[model samples]
Target: MSDTPQDSRRRYSAPVVDGVNKSAGRAMLRAVGFTDDDFRKPQVGIASTWSQVTPCNSHIDELAEVACQGADQAGGKGVIFNTITISDGIANGTEGMKYSLVSREVIADSIETVAACEGFDGLVAIGGCDKNMPGCLMGMARLNRPSVFVYGGTILPGDGHTDIVSVFEAVGAHAKGELSLIEVKQIEETAIPGPGACGGMYTANTMASAIEALGMSLPGSSAQNAVSNDKRADCAAAGAAVLELLAQDIKPSDIMTRAAFENAITLVIALGGSTNAVLHLIAMANTVGVALTLEDFTRLGKGVPVLADLRPSGHYMMSELVAIGGIQPLMKTLLEAGLLHGECLTVTGQTLADNLAGVAPYAAGQDIIRPLDNPIKPESHLRILYGNLAPEGAVAKITGKEGTRFAGTARVFGSEEEAQARILDGTVVAGDVLVIRYEGPRGGPGMREMLSPTSAIMGRGLGNDVALITDGRFSGGSHGFVVGHITPEAFDGGPLALVQDGDPIVIDAVADRIELQVDDQELERRRRAWQQPPPRYRRGVLAKYARTVSSASTGAVTDLPDTD
Candidate 1:
């Protein structure tokens, strides 16, 4: 690929000789058939999160090529580099999930290190799936470079009649005995076959859209299908956008302002985004020296109505969302309602208002995205709860039901296995608060999703009437009044560690509180006697994870620095 006349002019106008090491730029230019004069051209770094194991991002290799074409066309040098790819499925039953959360920090650190070492003037982050997007953003925040995210986009809908179902639906059917063992296996296989359909608005799609709404990704890039030609075009455009960003000297710090973070939060709730987003966003915000807390999520949830009727919370998929118009259209809806931060800047060097032009009519025809006047839900689909149970805070996605406040006796289960066995045996009752503890960051170390237990409880026909409370995390596809990521987890002698079987518990989604009926004195006494479990692992990643991983409220990122 060669630079176009317009690209050459843009490069010539900016002259990338700012911030970067002039000597390093000259050395790289010499190696790439450029002279001292060409050293003035913008240098763009392509931080690619592609690995053999992460199928969701396996296509990033080709996407990087597309980005390179754009970079060259824009008269900039694009250096492609690799980072760690963490797959949630392959990490089941281990501390891999915890490690995966920390992978974002590692990835961000890696990108920063590479950019500093190579003296690249700008960055194009090619990320897909859960952790990579946030990881890239965190790194970019520190570097404050002219950077943009290129999401690999979600997978296409599945092939079979049943295969096309969302992750929640598929899991629900299997749990309810509607699908046989062989059929369930087939559905799972077909649903996540390679580059797409990696579940619903779970972590992957949620992170992608959140980043897009945060102004880190190109507008309309969040909903493209991974294999579609549009995604390739978006990648190419992202490549060109980086060069433009460099020329304009617009760094991530310029775009990722407080208003942009708020916009991202509003979009997260309106879209019924993943519970994991709450954690990741906080971590990303912190990287930029911004103060974001669980309270912020609660406040935003109350004002932002649920508009996107997508899976886990609703009936559509990302591909369907794309067909109806993607983030651009959704932003238009928010903008029209006066809900968006109109002045926020985007990677395209235009105000959010400018980028949203003509998107309203396109969204009007698509029912997937509802207008603000008639939203799917009146407020944010998520809530932050607090009380003796969650002193710091816990999150719950309350969308499908109304009047869900209830006080019930606790049915405490120390492990997921016990909870599953009891639910399957019909031991659960209506108005019971199912408390599963010792599954938090320090508890499970991996902080595994409590999907199986939550689904089993629902399958036993006790979903609505019964409330599920845990110190663990829940999948984005999971619905119901399930409380997750209770800080100061049971393993660390939090209030959850003091709950006894048959104790009364209360969950008031409207009041935003989760409380154990036991008095504070009794809870304190129980906490005094609580004993921590023996260490699950003596060495390796598990031990390191246990030692360094923070709570979910902090993005569950590792406390250690990236050595490489």
Candidate 2:
């Protein structure tokens, strides 16, 4: 009930300090012959994932200042540093993109190394893009330090009405000949204006929100707009919150519990979040020694309906979601419905129940976030399917499609380029299972998003009829009968490698199956003669990725030992 800022002073306060010489702080303790007085102060490390190349996180330079300000305000010494920034949109084709998935582990490894050397008591992670957020989470999860995640919020909506359209709509317009190349360029330029724009929700926003909902961030910190002044205030608040976490001895492992993960799942589904959230959340849960499988996602999603009608899934943008009420209102709705675990503790030392008490009631009528009784979707929009083709498992967004039953003759495309050629030539058929090969982890090294072919199929007026299956990943913005993350990708000699043209394939979502109608004997015969695709990279990171990356079922992380 204490709203006074002074109330936070005792719990969140840090000790005041006399300024130390820069040279003295930088000198190695052993080299400088440091005394007990120097070592007594707790050191805070600010790990920022920012690069000029990463447009989403370009503003982090300014964001870092707010974090430092908070640490200083809390009477702690803050040392800010930078790390690798991976952009999925920019590194689309090259081998550098494949490195994006594994880069999280690398960043985490680097953080652990740096923390060891610097001897910091806690850490503040500034991650705004897709890989950066998960990478930071993975690092903090392993380090098990008093840490907090500060996300650069979503970008403001664009000016043009066409620019305000969902990502899929903009892409669809370009494909359907409704938008010219010149217009598409303009939209692309304006759609993502510097740091914090519409693209924020695409992958970055989803993962950042996931971080908060998991209780890793201060409540209400995840949904702020990136370019707004409020973002700076939130950053400072997060910096102060980290110090409070240190005082409470609250570590990342303490907050990211099984129930916390369940809360994240609820939030993700309610937001109509990115499918990549599944991979990142599973990886994160694993870091805490919690087993979270795709089935768990299916089960949790079934009871939790899609409540937020945000971009790629619905009409409004994330900025609107924040202005209306932010995660506070969403969590309030979930708690009132008894959908959230009220006992969960956040970084602020407040229980989820207490946090809900602070949020104002949602306005009477806002179509942006639907209520529990009246959701955007009746059940969880995400579902996992299994069959001979995807025995381990494959995921599909049930809400992204129309008809549940699809039977088609497989139209095999050995590469994405080949698939594009067929679609552009108008040679693709309606009843076709467009099997894309050599694009999975071992195949393409990067496991590129499957937009090229999916966009083409939708453009040809064959979206409803076509079923695009790949041992690769897809953008969360993509919709339709697309099956992604097929395990044991073709280059790795999985069954998908043997699939040939004219083979019958059936996709039955209601039954949760993706079956290849070909006989076992024929498939076995074809599999025996199938030659593995040559290495995509003879040297460099792609070569390393092909050697170390795990299958899609395993979150596509590098198969490195957990030494940290």
Candidate 3:
């Protein structure tokens, strides 16, 4: 609100860096390498979610240095900082995985704490894990400061094509006597070649691309390889871009409008992105006070087509798509076709149309990204279904490879571990709908992803023949006939807790309903007798989250009501 850019820049940072009265702040800054010249420039916090926990973020230290260089070169004093991260891959299928989703809130809180206390004028946040991208965006939205988000970049596939998804499926094959233990061991060894996110349209890449679509990241920044010069260049550009954001006072909320969120959702549909995006986008939008509901995603997906033939449900990897150029070409196709809103604001201080004005489409004969005339799927691969089972809503990825409808007898498991034990033991067979309840947000107390069970089903050659429904969620690498995020969760006494073995369940994508085919009278009787279970955790962060977190349909956020 100041008259001059310099005055506005000092509105926050000057309290710590510019005043003689605040000598203690300057002393602390001097201890950390801040000089007189540095004190004269606007302080920009460079937050890096770098850790050796997983390959996804291991390489971000070098990128942080690149960002500092960018900021210093652009006349801003960049101070690099670190935050906590957890490896979803390392913790998958274990009790520890309960902390994966919890890490998102911690990251946002810590980043906000550092910025607010340090009194930085702007921010450049870099994240690589499944949760880090959205966490950073949430912090930025809350801060409402000039900011830019940078993706660390997607990882390369092992042995050129097969990756961690292959390794997960290999365990199922070994269980079914389709793959030798030696071969499965080899797959585990070569699945991850180096540092980056799981090399597919998994959660990391999905959120990365989604952030770009949200106009928080630089153009074409989501698809570059993690170890490439282009990724470094993009990181540097983001650092410089944040200074521009500060100069123009272009805050994230300025670019993150309702139409902008729609543009991001449209891109997710085209990419056949992860179901987690539905949850994360809602939480992020809620930070900036945007009303993003499951119905909104369902409506926006109606006009978009699944044009990218990338992994999990498709036959391509992110690396392959990168070889033929990245998301820009595909975005250009959607923008020109009028599927995307071209007038939406971007991080570049230009309209989406301005960014795409000189962009080119994917080269001819590149089967990685299909043509507009002949798309992989006419409608979005992601679907939201509601019925007796999920009155609030549930997410399903129907890639068209898995038919539009599935009707089968339910095989109930009260927990994911129980379901996995049965699935790996060959007890889960075809023509069955596996029900894993009591694993939703308040149920599992974190709503773990079922990658192990889903991969096992695929490896056993039953990916298309069977279906799995859960109140929890799935990894981005999970495919086949699957439905997740059922609400209200079983712990809160939704219909899922009432499901018994042999009950006929139907998941009809064509009708957009996931139903439990029992009489209304019987359902009412069961509900009368059903009782909520005791809390799985009675202490610590997970317990706190279980207590405060809301339904999955509302983004599983822990914030107070928005009635304000």
Predicted model with the maximum TM-score: 3
Which regions of candidate 2 deviate over 4 angstroms? 1-39, 93-96, 161-176, 197-201, 459-461, 559-564
Candidate with better lDDT, 2 vs 3: 3
User: Model 1 over residues 103-217: C-alpha lDDT tens digits?
Assistant: 7767888988888776677889888767788888888887888888988888776655222233335455565677677776777667665585354666778888888888888
| Candidate 1 accuracy as TM-score | 0.88
Question: What's the ranking of the predictions by TM-score, best on top?
Answer: 3, 2, 1
User: TM per model?
Assistant: 0.88, 0.89, 0.98
- Residue runs of model 3 more than 4 Å from their true location after superposition: 1-5, 562-564
Model 3 lDDT per residue over 418-498, tens place: 988898899999899999998888989899999989999999999888999999999999999999999989999999999
lDDT of 2 by residue, 1-564 (tens): 113333232221122222254344434553534444434445567888777876678898889889977875886556687888776666643445666676776787777777655666778888877778888888888878788889877777665632223333555556667778887778766765556633424567788888888888877778888888888987888777777777778888888899999999888888888778877888788766777788888888778988877766467777888888787888888888887898998888888888778788779888888878888786776667888888888877656445777899998887767876776677787888889878887788777776656666665567788888888777665666888777778888877888989999998877888899988898889887888877968897778877887767767777434669
CA lDDT, every model vs. true structure: 0.76, 0.74, 0.89
Q: How close is candidate 2 to the true structure, as a TM-score?
A: 0.89
Best candidate per lDDT, number?
3
Off by over 4 Å in 1: 1-40, 93-95, 160-176, 197-199, 363-365, 417-431, 558-564
